[model samples]
Target: MGLTQTQKAMVEKARAAGGSGQAIPLSDDACVCLIGIIARDLGLSDHFPELPSDLPPFFDQREPGSLNISGVEFLPLMERLVKLNPDSDTFFSCLANLHKRRLKYERILQTQPIPTIEQVGPRGLLQFGTISATTLTGLLFWRKWFFDIDNRAGQETGYLFEPIIAHAIGGVPFSAKASPVRRAGDSRKGRQVDCIRQQKAYEFKIRVTIASSGQGRWQEELDFPVDCRQSRYTPVLVVLDATPNPKLDQLEAAFLRQQGEVYKGESAWEHLESVAGPTMGLFLEKYVRDPIQALLNKVSDCLPEFVARMDKDGITLSVAGESMLIRRTLGAADDEVQELPDDASDQIPGP
Candidate 1:
């Protein structure tokens, strides 16, 4: 097939690196075919069935029964492929293979005597040590989950932190009401809280664009709930913004500039502390400590009733107790097992 401009450039680069008199075991024609296969697999091209007439003469020349390329040559080609098609499934698959290779390489290294700082050079040792420490800390897993596309459904409704908090707490205790309730003799209807746990109200806001007055627009939205005296529920406000504002500064600063404040305006922050609550930072810390176990805890608490309902519909609860098994398998003995109210549903509000 006709090489795309990118593929042609990649070929030229490889030839330039190979230089004159460099005997590459793989024929240029074979390399082109391999590139075509890779491109098709990555969904980069659909014209792989037929070879194009306009291919460079280098690709046309061939005296090959089998193709071979050294690891040095293959590495550059793979790097180029990854750079060009990062989001492609083929690229991810290749990445996964590379990870496997890395694990194998680590195993080989482990068999040898551990190198001293002087032998490996202090900078090299420091880099390896930092990576090792980070991997052990489980930060990367949480970072991946935070940025994963599938988990971004909550962003649209300004409740992006709800799911993570809910999972950490083991279940969602309240559903978002479509309309706010206006009680008798009230000046305005009470603004709806995002979600409630144990009758304690929570509001989630994202301050991406600040208003002209150097304050978040959501700050205005908080006035009703924060000032609602008639309501029995204690309110808490969670804001996701990076700017320095008095409201956020007064609140407990979460990692990455996120902030959480228990509605201390009319009620004490301590009022909601006893009722299934954590500052946004603490909740995130727990989540980062172990997300799989956190999620499994949520599933364990919520899945029983779901399994029962499935049984009524003639569907089997095949995965019963698996969440607990996962927790045990992962050696998560230190995790606090939360038992949510059986009647509380774990479903979060959809965007």
Candidate 2:
């Protein structure tokens, strides 16, 4: 967004040395200047819309007449006014990713999920139900419906979370140029890395708790660290959930065998924030974590006792004698979710 402490220090150093707002030298290898250029095209920065263009006023150049990036061939990917930050906390931020993540949460709220009632089977209820059979049955239905939406949200979040965190820490989602171990008749390419910062290929996961992932998928997971090694990068595994699982153990063992680094739970968050620096860390907490926690709290308090009656069109969910018909389509604007354009931008209009 703006600048990291290290970047600020770089600016101060330049200013004190009569560098003014001038060009910094670009290198062949990954450096702060190149990193900043890559980081500029990302989200989770404090200065999203009203980006401070003047602060990070140093650009990367090879000669007085040549405007250059690390790879001369890829110079076009670098934009004008994209500045150098020693800490890789680029100059500007895009609201695109933040908007996309927010949209996933909004879709979860608007969606009126209705699982098949037949899923309950002949028993039509839980065996442990001692009182209020109807309420318990309704609760089970709600749980199933909620589960569908929750899983959908999780998958969508997976698609968004990588870049949001990756860019915040000045990394890019990487795809290995070549496959390390190609399968027979498989058209698949190299491993899709969550984030690649310099030579560190980071694999980010919320948690790995499945008892056994499918054999093919599990093997692919195991191959990730190997692919990173073959690509000449150090593997960094970041699992946000530390809950012990046999599957996670196996996958982690695979990484460790490849001399990879692993961080779990609090350590993972700390590692992300440590690289992301104070400003981007605070931005992530405020925009990403806080909103998610608030939504979880809101859902848990209400859904724990929710009663759903499903029919052909939709389902009627009742709580405390209040009923609302929910269809598969998006619901009416409520206190929680407001109507927003599909192309949500930095300038969100007041409702």
Candidate 3:
């Protein structure tokens, strides 16, 4: 939060130039950091959660470049920010400055988190305080859906997690439009590299462990590096989990073979945020990682007292001394049970 190295250098430059009464110059990152500090001091972070966290990197010197935002760019942002305020209570110039500050924020959200969540659909509301029957249902519902939906749909939606971080770090879905370097298996279905940006091909994994997976998938993973190198791209691997595994070691070797880079666990997060720049960096921290961690921490505090069971009958949820059996019908997914009376349960049943 204090002056960053870049800011310090600029300060020294300003001091030297002060005798001539010349205007002090601020680098793009330094200017952004000052704004963030000002917002924090003014306690405006609640209005813009991405404020302080997003601004740190600029000060940290991770993002060093000219921030060329012309009026062409400013107009769209001004229009959007203006729309947010229906009331015109002394906010003409304020909105302009506000949008200038939050330039990358809305775009990052629109391009990243919003789309990822849309696939998951809405999580039903939870009423806090006492453990209500409805609250328990929400917990049981997600856990049940995770397994049941996975088995039925034959999809691992957790794979969606990788793209979230990759895109946050400026990598986009591997497409001819996104990058010129396409890997051997660049088809939409048999996607090889997780994403690509500039001349780097990225492979993102939540974790890599000793546990064995499909040989075909392992082969594809191995092939990714070779394919990327062939396309004149550097294959970079990012794994979020640090759990040590021989398989992970092997995978690292694969990337090393291609003269690529590997980042795991804390380093992976650091690499991602550093590359994400200010706007997308905040998006990763605020909307993505922080929320996920908070969710886990919240759940860990008082774990949900809910259970889900799937049988030939169907899926059933039992929580708060109540049971709801969703019976499955032929050619339709449940589609199963009640364990006890609903005397103390909240009246949240679909019926």
lDDT of 2: 0.52
TM-score of each: 0.26, 0.50, 0.45
The deviation in Å at residue 261 for candidate 3 is: 0.7
Candidate structures ordered by lDDT, highest first? 2, 3, 1
Model 3 misses residue 289 by how many Å?
1.9
- Sort by TM-score, best first: what order? 2, 3, 1
User: Compared with the true structure, what per-residue lDDT tens digits does model 1 show for residues 199-269?
Assistant: 44565444322344434644544343433334544445644333456555433332112223443321322
Candidate 2, 198-272: lDDT as tens digits: 789888886787754588778888887777776678889998767788888888998898899999877887888
lDDT of each: 0.35, 0.52, 0.48
Better of 1 and 3 by TM-score: 3
Error of 1 at 191 (Å): 3.2
Model 3 TM-score, all chains together: 0.45
Clashing pairs in 2: none
Off by over 4 Å in 1: 1-160, 170-190, 205-219, 226-228, 239-243, 247-283, 286-351
Q: Give the per-residue Cα lDDT of candidate 3 at 293.
A: 60
